[model samples]
Target: MQKSFLIVVIVAIVGGLAIHQFVPALSASIAFFAGAIIAALLFKLLPSALSQGDGEYSGPMMTLYVGNLPYRVHEGEVKELFSQYGEVCSVRLVRDRKTGRRKGFGFVEMPEASAQQAMAQLNDFVFQERTIKVREAKTQDSDSTEKNPV
Candidate 1:
Protein backbone atom coordinates (compact mmCIF):
# COMPACT_ATOMS: atom_id res chain seq x y z
CA MET A 1 0.00 0.00 0.00
CA GLN A 2 2.72 2.44 1.01
CA LYS A 3 4.81 1.66 -2.09
CA SER A 4 1.88 2.12 -4.42
CA PHE A 5 0.92 5.36 -2.74
CA LEU A 6 4.46 6.67 -3.09
CA ILE A 7 4.56 5.68 -6.77
CA VAL A 8 1.29 7.48 -7.41
CA VAL A 9 2.52 10.63 -5.68
CA ILE A 10 5.76 10.58 -7.68
CA VAL A 11 3.90 10.12 -10.95
CA ALA A 12 1.55 12.96 -10.16
CA ILE A 13 4.38 15.33 -9.19
CA VAL A 14 6.36 14.51 -12.33
CA GLY A 15 3.33 14.90 -14.54
CA GLY A 16 2.41 18.22 -12.93
CA LEU A 17 5.93 19.59 -13.31
CA ALA A 18 6.16 18.48 -16.93
CA ILE A 19 2.85 20.11 -17.76
CA HIS A 20 3.83 23.28 -15.93
CA GLN A 21 7.11 23.56 -17.86
CA PHE A 22 5.78 22.67 -21.33
CA VAL A 23 2.32 24.24 -21.15
CA PRO A 24 2.82 27.76 -19.83
CA ALA A 25 -0.72 28.85 -20.74
CA LEU A 26 -2.29 26.07 -18.70
CA SER A 27 0.29 26.12 -15.91
CA ALA A 28 -1.65 28.47 -13.65
CA SER A 29 -4.87 26.49 -13.83
CA ILE A 30 -3.03 23.21 -13.48
CA ALA A 31 -1.12 24.47 -10.46
CA PHE A 32 -4.31 25.64 -8.80
CA PHE A 33 -6.04 22.29 -9.26
CA ALA A 34 -2.90 20.33 -8.35
CA GLY A 35 -2.54 22.20 -5.07
CA ALA A 36 -6.20 21.63 -4.22
CA ILE A 37 -5.90 17.92 -5.05
CA ILE A 38 -2.79 17.57 -2.90
CA ALA A 39 -4.44 19.32 0.01
CA ALA A 40 -7.52 17.11 -0.21
CA LEU A 41 -5.40 14.00 -0.42
CA LEU A 42 -3.32 14.98 2.60
CA PHE A 43 -6.04 16.29 4.88
CA LYS A 44 -8.90 14.00 3.91
CA LEU A 45 -7.52 10.78 2.50
CA LEU A 46 -4.37 10.50 4.61
CA PRO A 47 -6.26 10.74 7.88
CA SER A 48 -8.74 8.01 7.04
CA ALA A 49 -6.00 5.83 5.65
CA LEU A 50 -3.97 6.11 8.84
CA SER A 51 -6.80 5.74 11.31
CA GLN A 52 -7.53 2.11 12.12
CA GLY A 53 -10.34 2.61 14.58
CA ASP A 54 -13.84 3.94 14.04
CA GLY A 55 -13.95 7.06 11.87
CA GLU A 56 -13.99 9.83 14.43
CA TYR A 57 -11.62 12.74 14.07
CA SER A 58 -11.96 15.77 16.28
CA GLY A 59 -9.85 18.68 15.18
CA PRO A 60 -8.09 21.02 17.59
CA MET A 61 -10.11 24.03 16.54
CA MET A 62 -12.92 25.19 18.83
CA THR A 63 -16.03 27.11 17.88
CA LEU A 64 -17.48 29.58 20.36
CA TYR A 65 -20.98 30.88 20.64
CA VAL A 66 -20.97 34.63 21.04
CA GLY A 67 -24.16 36.29 22.23
CA ASN A 68 -25.39 39.78 22.92
CA LEU A 69 -23.22 41.31 20.26
CA PRO A 70 -24.39 44.81 19.57
CA TYR A 71 -26.33 44.98 16.30
CA ARG A 72 -23.49 47.07 14.94
CA VAL A 73 -20.80 44.50 15.55
CA HIS A 74 -19.46 42.81 12.43
CA GLU A 75 -17.22 39.87 11.66
CA GLY A 76 -14.04 41.94 11.48
CA GLU A 77 -14.71 43.56 14.85
CA VAL A 78 -15.36 40.23 16.50
CA LYS A 79 -12.25 38.72 14.90
CA GLU A 80 -10.13 41.64 16.12
CA LEU A 81 -11.48 41.32 19.65
CA PHE A 82 -10.85 37.56 19.83
CA SER A 83 -7.44 37.82 18.13
CA GLN A 84 -6.06 39.51 21.24
CA TYR A 85 -6.10 36.14 22.97
CA GLY A 86 -4.92 33.95 20.08
CA GLU A 87 -5.30 33.23 16.39
CA VAL A 88 -8.88 33.60 15.30
CA CYS A 89 -9.66 31.32 12.40
CA SER A 90 -13.10 32.63 11.45
CA VAL A 91 -15.92 34.84 12.66
CA ARG A 92 -19.48 34.47 11.49
CA LEU A 93 -22.06 37.05 12.50
CA VAL A 94 -25.47 35.53 12.21
CA ARG A 95 -27.91 37.60 10.18
CA ASP A 96 -31.65 37.62 9.67
CA ARG A 97 -32.47 35.96 6.38
CA LYS A 98 -35.57 37.99 5.60
CA THR A 99 -34.47 41.48 6.61
CA GLY A 100 -30.69 40.96 6.19
CA ARG A 101 -29.89 42.42 9.60
CA ARG A 102 -27.44 41.48 12.27
CA LYS A 103 -28.90 38.99 14.77
CA GLY A 104 -26.83 40.07 17.82
CA PHE A 105 -25.20 36.64 17.97
CA GLY A 106 -22.43 34.84 16.10
CA PHE A 107 -19.86 32.08 16.13
CA VAL A 108 -16.08 32.36 16.31
CA GLU A 109 -13.57 29.66 15.53
CA MET A 110 -10.09 29.49 17.05
CA PRO A 111 -7.60 27.07 18.44
CA GLU A 112 -8.82 25.25 21.55
CA ALA A 113 -6.40 26.98 23.94
CA SER A 114 -7.10 30.37 22.42
CA ALA A 115 -10.84 29.78 22.65
CA GLN A 116 -10.56 29.00 26.37
CA GLN A 117 -8.61 32.18 26.96
CA ALA A 118 -11.05 34.28 24.95
CA MET A 119 -14.07 32.76 26.69
CA ALA A 120 -12.59 33.31 30.14
CA GLN A 121 -11.76 36.94 29.48
CA LEU A 122 -14.69 37.94 27.29
CA ASN A 123 -17.72 36.21 28.76
CA ASP A 124 -19.95 38.90 30.22
CA PHE A 125 -17.44 41.49 29.12
CA VAL A 126 -19.14 44.71 28.31
CA PHE A 127 -18.54 45.71 24.70
CA GLN A 128 -20.26 48.38 22.65
CA GLU A 129 -22.75 49.10 25.48
CA ARG A 130 -23.75 45.46 25.80
CA THR A 131 -22.51 42.60 27.96
CA ILE A 132 -21.27 39.93 25.54
CA LYS A 133 -21.67 36.26 26.36
CA VAL A 134 -18.97 33.90 25.10
CA ARG A 135 -19.01 30.12 25.49
CA GLU A 136 -18.45 26.96 23.51
CA ALA A 137 -21.07 26.55 20.82
CA LYS A 138 -23.44 23.73 21.59
CA THR A 139 -24.13 20.87 19.20
CA GLN A 140 -27.28 20.89 17.08
CA ASP A 141 -29.39 18.85 19.51
CA SER A 142 -28.54 20.97 22.54
CA ASP A 143 -29.07 24.17 20.57
CA SER A 144 -32.51 23.01 19.47
CA THR A 145 -33.50 22.13 23.05
CA GLU A 146 -32.43 25.57 24.27
CA LYS A 147 -34.54 27.24 21.61
CA ASN A 148 -37.62 25.04 22.04
CA PRO A 149 -37.41 24.83 25.88
CA VAL A 150 -40.01 22.17 26.57
Candidate 2:
Protein backbone atom coordinates (compact mmCIF):
# COMPACT_ATOMS: atom_id res chain seq x y z
CA MET A 1 0.00 0.00 0.00
CA GLN A 2 2.72 2.46 0.96
CA LYS A 3 4.77 1.45 -2.09
CA SER A 4 1.82 2.14 -4.31
CA PHE A 5 1.41 5.62 -2.84
CA LEU A 6 5.08 6.37 -3.42
CA ILE A 7 4.84 5.24 -7.01
CA VAL A 8 1.82 7.46 -7.59
CA VAL A 9 3.67 10.44 -6.13
CA ILE A 10 6.69 9.87 -8.38
CA VAL A 11 4.43 9.54 -11.42
CA ALA A 12 2.73 12.82 -10.60
CA ILE A 13 6.04 14.65 -10.36
CA VAL A 14 7.33 13.11 -13.58
CA GLY A 15 4.12 13.92 -15.41
CA GLY A 16 4.30 17.51 -14.14
CA LEU A 17 7.80 17.94 -15.57
CA ALA A 18 6.86 16.28 -18.89
CA ILE A 19 3.97 18.70 -19.29
CA HIS A 20 6.18 21.70 -18.48
CA GLN A 21 6.08 22.83 -22.18
CA PHE A 22 4.07 25.95 -21.32
CA VAL A 23 5.24 28.22 -18.47
CA PRO A 24 1.84 28.82 -16.82
CA ALA A 25 0.67 25.18 -16.99
CA LEU A 26 4.13 24.01 -15.90
CA SER A 27 4.04 26.05 -12.70
CA ALA A 28 0.54 24.80 -11.82
CA SER A 29 1.55 21.19 -12.45
CA ILE A 30 4.67 21.56 -10.31
CA ALA A 31 2.60 23.05 -7.48
CA PHE A 32 0.08 20.21 -7.76
CA PHE A 33 2.83 17.59 -7.55
CA ALA A 34 4.36 19.27 -4.52
CA GLY A 35 0.98 19.26 -2.76
CA ALA A 36 0.38 15.61 -3.61
CA ILE A 37 3.79 14.57 -2.22
CA ILE A 38 3.20 16.36 1.06
CA ALA A 39 -0.34 15.03 1.35
CA ALA A 40 0.81 11.46 0.79
CA LEU A 41 3.50 11.75 3.44
CA LEU A 42 1.07 13.14 5.97
CA PHE A 43 -1.49 10.41 5.23
CA LYS A 44 1.13 7.75 5.83
CA LEU A 45 2.25 9.28 9.12
CA LEU A 46 -0.80 10.82 10.78
CA PRO A 47 -1.60 7.84 13.07
CA SER A 48 1.83 7.98 14.69
CA ALA A 49 1.08 11.45 16.03
CA LEU A 50 -1.23 9.85 18.64
CA SER A 51 1.57 7.70 20.08
CA GLN A 52 4.81 9.38 19.02
CA GLY A 53 5.89 13.01 19.32
CA ASP A 54 8.54 15.30 20.85
CA GLY A 55 8.15 13.85 24.37
CA GLU A 56 4.85 15.66 24.73
CA TYR A 57 3.15 12.59 26.20
CA SER A 58 5.78 10.20 27.44
CA GLY A 59 3.58 8.11 29.71
CA PRO A 60 -0.19 7.88 29.90
CA MET A 61 -1.56 8.91 33.26
CA MET A 62 -4.93 7.74 34.54
CA THR A 63 -7.32 9.24 37.04
CA LEU A 64 -9.36 6.73 38.98
CA TYR A 65 -12.37 7.19 41.18
CA VAL A 66 -12.40 4.51 43.81
CA GLY A 67 -15.27 3.85 46.16
CA ASN A 68 -15.69 1.81 49.34
CA LEU A 69 -11.97 1.45 49.93
CA PRO A 70 -12.39 0.46 53.57
CA TYR A 71 -11.29 3.98 54.50
CA ARG A 72 -7.76 2.55 54.72
CA VAL A 73 -6.74 2.64 51.09
CA HIS A 74 -3.43 4.41 50.58
CA GLU A 75 -1.12 5.08 47.71
CA GLY A 76 0.30 1.61 48.09
CA GLU A 77 -3.08 0.00 47.55
CA VAL A 78 -3.73 2.09 44.46
CA LYS A 79 -0.35 1.08 43.05
CA GLU A 80 -1.09 -2.53 43.82
CA LEU A 81 -4.46 -2.39 42.10
CA PHE A 82 -3.11 -0.89 38.91
CA SER A 83 0.10 -2.91 38.91
CA GLN A 84 -1.77 -5.84 37.41
CA TYR A 85 -1.74 -3.99 34.07
CA GLY A 86 1.68 -2.32 34.08
CA GLU A 87 4.47 -0.81 36.16
CA VAL A 88 3.05 1.82 38.41
CA CYS A 89 5.22 4.92 38.17
CA SER A 90 3.26 6.91 40.74
CA VAL A 91 -0.01 6.79 42.68
CA ARG A 92 -1.38 9.87 44.31
CA LEU A 93 -4.61 9.81 46.29
CA VAL A 94 -6.45 13.08 46.21
CA ARG A 95 -6.68 14.31 49.78
CA ASP A 96 -7.56 17.29 51.87
CA ARG A 97 -4.13 18.83 52.28
CA LYS A 98 -4.80 19.83 55.90
CA THR A 99 -6.63 16.67 56.94
CA GLY A 100 -4.49 14.21 54.99
CA ARG A 101 -7.32 11.84 54.08
CA ARG A 102 -8.28 10.13 50.85
CA LYS A 103 -10.85 11.96 48.75
CA GLY A 104 -12.01 8.80 46.89
CA PHE A 105 -9.96 9.64 43.83
CA GLY A 106 -6.35 9.27 42.68
CA PHE A 107 -4.00 9.38 39.72
CA VAL A 108 -1.66 6.71 38.39
CA GLU A 109 0.99 6.93 35.72
CA MET A 110 2.23 4.15 33.43
CA PRO A 111 3.64 3.76 29.95
CA GLU A 112 1.36 5.14 27.25
CA ALA A 113 0.49 1.79 25.71
CA SER A 114 0.06 0.16 29.11
CA ALA A 115 -2.14 2.93 30.37
CA GLN A 116 -4.37 2.65 27.34
CA GLN A 117 -4.59 -1.09 27.79
CA ALA A 118 -5.39 -0.71 31.47
CA MET A 119 -8.13 1.79 30.79
CA ALA A 120 -9.77 -0.47 28.21
CA GLN A 121 -9.58 -3.48 30.53
CA LEU A 122 -10.26 -1.88 33.89
CA ASN A 123 -12.58 1.03 33.35
CA ASP A 124 -15.40 -0.55 35.32
CA PHE A 125 -13.77 -3.55 36.97
CA VAL A 126 -14.62 -4.13 40.57
CA PHE A 127 -11.99 -3.69 43.26
CA GLN A 128 -12.25 -3.82 47.03
CA GLU A 129 -16.00 -4.26 46.81
CA ARG A 130 -16.55 -1.19 44.62
CA THR A 131 -16.55 -0.48 40.93
CA ILE A 132 -13.88 1.96 39.82
CA LYS A 133 -13.88 4.66 37.17
CA VAL A 134 -10.59 4.80 35.30
CA ARG A 135 -9.60 7.02 32.39
CA GLU A 136 -6.89 9.28 31.01
CA ALA A 137 -5.90 12.04 33.39
CA LYS A 138 -6.97 15.45 32.24
CA THR A 139 -4.47 18.20 32.82
CA GLN A 140 -5.43 21.21 34.92
CA ASP A 141 -5.16 23.44 31.89
CA SER A 142 -7.62 21.23 30.03
CA ASP A 143 -10.15 21.30 32.84
CA SER A 144 -10.10 25.04 33.33
CA THR A 145 -12.29 27.25 31.19
CA GLU A 146 -10.89 30.50 29.87
CA LYS A 147 -12.75 33.38 31.43
CA ASN A 148 -12.89 36.61 29.50
CA PRO A 149 -13.25 39.38 32.07
CA VAL A 150 -15.19 41.94 30.14
Candidate 3:
Protein backbone atom coordinates (compact mmCIF):
# COMPACT_ATOMS: atom_id res chain seq x y z
CA MET A 1 0.00 0.00 0.00
CA GLN A 2 2.74 2.41 0.93
CA LYS A 3 4.66 1.55 -2.22
CA SER A 4 1.67 2.31 -4.37
CA PHE A 5 1.06 5.58 -2.57
CA LEU A 6 4.66 6.67 -3.03
CA ILE A 7 4.54 5.76 -6.69
CA VAL A 8 1.31 7.70 -7.15
CA VAL A 9 2.74 10.76 -5.42
CA ILE A 10 5.97 10.76 -7.40
CA VAL A 11 4.22 10.19 -10.71
CA ALA A 12 1.69 12.89 -9.92
CA ILE A 13 4.37 15.43 -9.16
CA VAL A 14 6.38 14.62 -12.28
CA GLY A 15 3.28 14.61 -14.45
CA GLY A 16 2.14 17.92 -13.05
CA LEU A 17 5.45 19.47 -13.94
CA ALA A 18 5.37 18.04 -17.47
CA ILE A 19 1.82 19.21 -18.03
CA HIS A 20 2.64 22.65 -16.73
CA GLN A 21 5.37 22.86 -19.33
CA PHE A 22 3.08 21.81 -22.19
CA VAL A 23 -0.09 23.60 -21.13
CA PRO A 24 0.42 26.52 -18.77
CA ALA A 25 -3.34 27.11 -18.45
CA LEU A 26 -4.14 23.67 -16.99
CA SER A 27 -4.26 23.66 -13.20
CA ALA A 28 -1.62 21.67 -11.29
CA SER A 29 -4.43 19.84 -9.51
CA ILE A 30 -5.82 18.54 -12.80
CA ALA A 31 -2.41 17.40 -13.98
CA PHE A 32 -1.77 15.57 -10.71
CA PHE A 33 -5.19 13.91 -10.93
CA ALA A 34 -4.43 12.62 -14.41
CA GLY A 35 -1.09 11.21 -13.30
CA ALA A 36 -2.66 9.63 -10.23
CA ILE A 37 -5.19 7.88 -12.43
CA ILE A 38 -2.43 6.53 -14.67
CA ALA A 39 -0.48 5.30 -11.66
CA ALA A 40 -3.49 3.47 -10.27
CA LEU A 41 -4.03 1.73 -13.58
CA LEU A 42 -0.43 0.60 -13.60
CA PHE A 43 -0.71 -0.58 -10.00
CA LYS A 44 -3.69 -2.74 -10.88
CA LEU A 45 -1.53 -4.59 -13.37
CA LEU A 46 1.23 -5.28 -10.82
CA PRO A 47 -0.48 -8.23 -9.15
CA SER A 48 -1.22 -9.92 -12.44
CA ALA A 49 2.40 -9.56 -13.52
CA LEU A 50 3.70 -11.08 -10.26
CA SER A 51 1.12 -13.86 -10.34
CA GLN A 52 2.65 -15.33 -13.43
CA GLY A 53 6.11 -16.98 -13.04
CA ASP A 54 7.28 -19.67 -10.59
CA GLY A 55 6.80 -19.08 -6.86
CA GLU A 56 5.76 -21.03 -3.81
CA TYR A 57 2.10 -20.12 -3.40
CA SER A 58 0.44 -21.99 -0.57
CA GLY A 59 -3.19 -22.53 -1.51
CA PRO A 60 -5.71 -25.14 -2.45
CA MET A 61 -5.45 -26.92 -5.74
CA MET A 62 -7.79 -25.78 -8.49
CA THR A 63 -9.54 -27.69 -11.24
CA LEU A 64 -10.13 -26.00 -14.58
CA TYR A 65 -12.46 -26.97 -17.41
CA VAL A 66 -11.05 -26.84 -20.89
CA GLY A 67 -13.48 -26.63 -23.77
CA ASN A 68 -13.60 -26.38 -27.57
CA LEU A 69 -10.61 -28.65 -27.96
CA PRO A 70 -9.83 -30.38 -31.22
CA TYR A 71 -10.94 -34.00 -31.10
CA ARG A 72 -7.54 -35.08 -32.30
CA VAL A 73 -5.79 -33.66 -29.25
CA HIS A 74 -4.99 -36.12 -26.47
CA GLU A 75 -4.78 -35.74 -22.73
CA GLY A 76 -0.99 -35.71 -22.85
CA GLU A 77 -1.06 -32.86 -25.34
CA VAL A 78 -3.31 -30.80 -23.15
CA LYS A 79 -1.20 -31.50 -20.09
CA GLU A 80 1.95 -30.50 -21.91
CA LEU A 81 0.46 -27.19 -22.97
CA PHE A 82 -0.83 -26.34 -19.51
CA SER A 83 2.40 -27.43 -17.80
CA GLN A 84 4.17 -24.51 -19.39
CA TYR A 85 2.35 -22.23 -16.95
CA GLY A 86 2.76 -24.43 -13.85
CA GLU A 87 3.00 -27.92 -12.49
CA VAL A 88 0.01 -29.83 -13.87
CA CYS A 89 -1.35 -32.24 -11.25
CA SER A 90 -3.55 -34.13 -13.66
CA VAL A 91 -5.33 -33.89 -16.99
CA ARG A 92 -8.45 -35.82 -17.92
CA LEU A 93 -10.05 -35.52 -21.34
CA VAL A 94 -13.64 -36.62 -21.32
CA ARG A 95 -14.84 -39.27 -23.68
CA ASP A 96 -18.19 -40.87 -24.52
CA ARG A 97 -18.50 -44.02 -22.43
CA LYS A 98 -20.64 -45.91 -24.91
CA THR A 99 -18.50 -45.38 -27.98
CA GLY A 100 -15.28 -44.47 -26.16
CA ARG A 101 -14.87 -41.47 -28.45
CA ARG A 102 -13.47 -38.05 -27.72
CA LYS A 103 -15.84 -35.43 -26.30
CA GLY A 104 -13.62 -32.45 -27.18
CA PHE A 105 -13.22 -31.23 -23.61
CA GLY A 106 -11.17 -31.94 -20.50
CA PHE A 107 -10.35 -31.03 -16.91
CA VAL A 108 -6.94 -29.96 -15.66
CA GLU A 109 -5.91 -29.89 -12.02
CA MET A 110 -3.10 -27.70 -10.71
CA PRO A 111 -2.13 -25.25 -8.03
CA GLU A 112 -4.56 -22.33 -7.72
CA ALA A 113 -2.14 -19.56 -8.61
CA SER A 114 -0.77 -21.36 -11.63
CA ALA A 115 -4.27 -22.33 -12.67
CA GLN A 116 -5.17 -18.63 -12.75
CA GLN A 117 -2.20 -17.91 -14.97
CA ALA A 118 -3.13 -20.72 -17.29
CA MET A 119 -6.72 -19.57 -17.57
CA ALA A 120 -5.67 -16.02 -18.40
CA GLN A 121 -3.32 -17.14 -21.14
CA LEU A 122 -5.16 -20.17 -22.48
CA ASN A 123 -8.74 -18.93 -22.57
CA ASP A 124 -9.74 -18.20 -26.17
CA PHE A 125 -6.31 -19.37 -27.31
CA VAL A 126 -6.06 -21.06 -30.68
CA PHE A 127 -4.54 -24.54 -30.72
CA GLN A 128 -4.30 -26.89 -33.63
CA GLU A 129 -6.50 -24.65 -35.77
CA ARG A 130 -9.21 -24.49 -33.11
CA THR A 131 -9.99 -22.01 -30.36
CA ILE A 132 -10.06 -23.32 -26.80
CA LYS A 133 -11.58 -22.01 -23.59
CA VAL A 134 -10.16 -22.39 -20.10
CA ARG A 135 -12.17 -21.68 -16.98
CA GLU A 136 -12.79 -22.86 -13.43
CA ALA A 137 -14.75 -26.09 -13.26
CA LYS A 138 -18.30 -25.83 -11.97
CA THR A 139 -18.55 -28.05 -8.93
CA GLN A 140 -21.66 -30.14 -8.46
CA ASP A 141 -23.69 -29.83 -5.28
CA SER A 142 -22.61 -32.26 -2.61
CA ASP A 143 -26.23 -33.10 -1.76
CA SER A 144 -27.09 -34.75 -5.00
CA THR A 145 -30.74 -34.88 -6.19
CA GLU A 146 -30.72 -38.66 -5.93
CA LYS A 147 -29.89 -38.45 -2.24
CA ASN A 148 -32.81 -36.09 -1.55
CA PRO A 149 -35.29 -37.90 -3.82
CA VAL A 150 -37.17 -35.19 -5.73
Best by lDDT: 3
Model 1 spans with C-alpha error above 4 angstroms: 1-59, 144-150
Which stretch of 10 consecutive residues in model 1 shows the poorest summed lDDT?
49-58
lDDT of 1 by residue, 71-92 (tens): 9987999999999998887899
Q: Evaluated with TM-score, which candidate comes out highest?
A: 1
Task: Evaluate model 2: give its lDDT.
Answer: 0.66
Which tens-of-lDDT digit does each residue in 49-75 have in candidate 2?
432433334454555444444456778
Q: Each candidate: what lDDT?
A: 0.82, 0.66, 0.84
In candidate 1, position 15 carries an lDDT of 60
Alpha-carbon shift of residue 46 in model 2 (angstroms): 36
Task: Itemize residue pairs with steric clashes in candidate 1.
Answer: none
Q: What TM-score would you give candidate 1 relative to the actual structure?
A: 0.59
